[model samples]
Target: MKIGVLTIGAELLNGARIDTNSNWISKTVIDHGGMVEFNISTKDNQSSIIKALDFLLDQSIDMIIMTGGLGPTHDDITAKTLFEYFDDIPILDEKYWNFLVSRFKKKGFKVSALNKTLALKPSNGKIIDNPIGTARGLHFSSNKKEIIALPGVPSEMKSMMREATLPMIKKISQKSIHSSILRTTGITESSLYEKLFSLIKQAPDVELAFLPSLFGVDLRTSSTDNDKFSNFLMQVKILLDEFIYSDKNLELEEVVVNLLNNHNLTVATAESCTGGLIGDRITNTSGASKVFKGGIIAYSNEIKINQLGVKKETIQKFGAVSIETASEMAAGVQKLFSTDIGISSTGIAGPLGGNKDKPVGLVYIAISINGVTTVYKNNFKSNRKNNKRITSQVALNLVRKELLKF
Candidate 1:
């Protein structure tokens, strides 16, 4: 089915608000095996909306899904415009109005008179209830095409789309779509493409998209062929065994936390340049308290030496960002917190404070497992926030690799 989406809002055209509704609808359509051929955003003005709607009709769209401008305010004009285009006017839906009044009474809130506007629908349209909001969705089905208009709010739209729209979409569409994401860290996107080149070529039907960020690269693959998708994914896991940290698109920290929980081990961190960011990530994972002991923001040389038991000599000799200091910090944190695993990060994230020998974005991450420690030296190119994020991810991936040993 070739579907076209129209997102109506003056705010979107003026950049006052982002049109997340269009993206959500497009993805939802594809998930139900409907192809979204065109997506256009228009002002809430009646003339602009009419133009957009006519364009979709002229293109012979099988379905036209519209979002926004369904509120009671005068600026919300999508429904009135749509009704006029069909050479008709809206009529009050008395049944829906009664339901709305009853619902409001049941909820113990005085029903606002403005909400009555939501019960008005096109004379020939079908009404879809909105349990989450007051704006009822309007559905118009014709022999040649279907038109569905949903509330602009995300939660309300998502609920109605999944609970109502998707079933109808699936019944009309022939294809079945499935999307999967594989996440990896401690490796470059280019390297992944090089290694998976052969396997990707084997699954010529699967559409693959690479999304890279400060944390890592996510390989998103979508397919309409279930059998081929499963087989192709199995090959991906086999080829990138150690590098594939998450096949279900879980965050790297979440993966590490779960692994540690399974192993019944504990973790702690001693952070320098990252400033307890590693600890923050770990704690963000639910049930992290089961495995995470504590962390120390050993950002200063004095704190590293005094609190984490890092040798004053180590910092003075090799500087605070050196591998030796990082190793000591990891070992010290593990010993201090009595955790099975300890991770540490020391870096120079900067647009300043760089020298020829040790340039900015130099990060040394160390992970100590039961007193044995290993460190990795990395250099990233980005702003301070991104550099810190990369350091935390690398440190977590290092812990993840070590945990795989047991």
Candidate 2:
């Protein structure tokens, strides 16, 4: 099945809201053996919505799933635009309207007049249940083309897709597509591709994609053949052994946390320039309290000295962003928090605050285990925000690699 995704929101175009619906729908479609032909984002206007729909239809897509413009607000015009484009009339769903009234009444609130707009469904459409929200999802079909309209809210849209859309697509689709994501840090996308090029060339049936973000390079490969996919995965493990931290697309922090859990160990972090980013990542993982003791954000030299017990002399000699300071910070945190492992990130993330000897984006990540501290230096070339992100990623990877040894 060939599918297209349409995201309609002025907020998305204006950067007020990100259009995450397209990615979710596209991935869901691909997972259910449907090929995503195109993804288009448009402003929340009738003309633009209609035009984008027509453009997708021109591609002869079997289905087009649209998200956004399906609320009670005046700008929410997806249903009206869709009705006009399909030459359909809005049929009031009295059953749903009553249900909505009863739902609101249960919450000790009266249904407002604006809320009634959600009860209107296209005459040629089937109402998709929005169990979690007010906006009802709709599926319209004419001849060979089908259009599925979902809520713009991520949780609502995901629930509707999983409950209704995926099953529907599965029944109509013949092709089965499977994908795997191998996440690797401390390796550039180009370098990873070069290492895996020969293996990729040998597997003609599988498609390899290098997705790079601040976290790392995610090597995603999709294949119709189970054998080819399995072979590609095996070769990837062999080819990129040291760099491949995760075979299941787990984040660096999650991977490290799991390793720590398995080893029955706990960790703490002392952050300087990265400013508690490493701690934030670790605590984001579920059940992190089991392995994460706590963290100290020693952004200032005095805090590093008093809070994390970093020697003032080390900072004076080598600076806060140096390996010596980072190593001391890690060791200090390990001793302070009484953790089995300690990690620290100290760096210069800036467009300014750089000199001849110490430049911006100069990061030193240190991990202390069993009183032995190892520090890795990185000179990332990016703005402050990206430099922070890069430093955090490497810090987590360092923890991950160290935990792997045990």
The estimated TM-scores of all candidates read 0.88, 0.95
Q: For candidate 2, write residues 216-244 as lDDT tens digits.
A: 78887888898888888888988888988
Question: Looking at candidate 2, what is the lDDT of residue 307?
Answer: 91
In the order shown, what is each candidate's alpha-carbon RMSD? 2.8, 1.7
Mark the 10 consecutive residues where model 1 has the least summed lDDT.
Answer: 23-32
Query: In every candidate, how many clashes are there?
Result: 0, 0
lDDT of 1 by residue, 151-252 (tens): 899999999999888888899887788777898776789999998898888888997777777677888777888899888888888878887889876888
lDDT of 1 at 87: 65
Error of 1 at 81 (Å): 2.5
Off by over 4 Å in 2: none
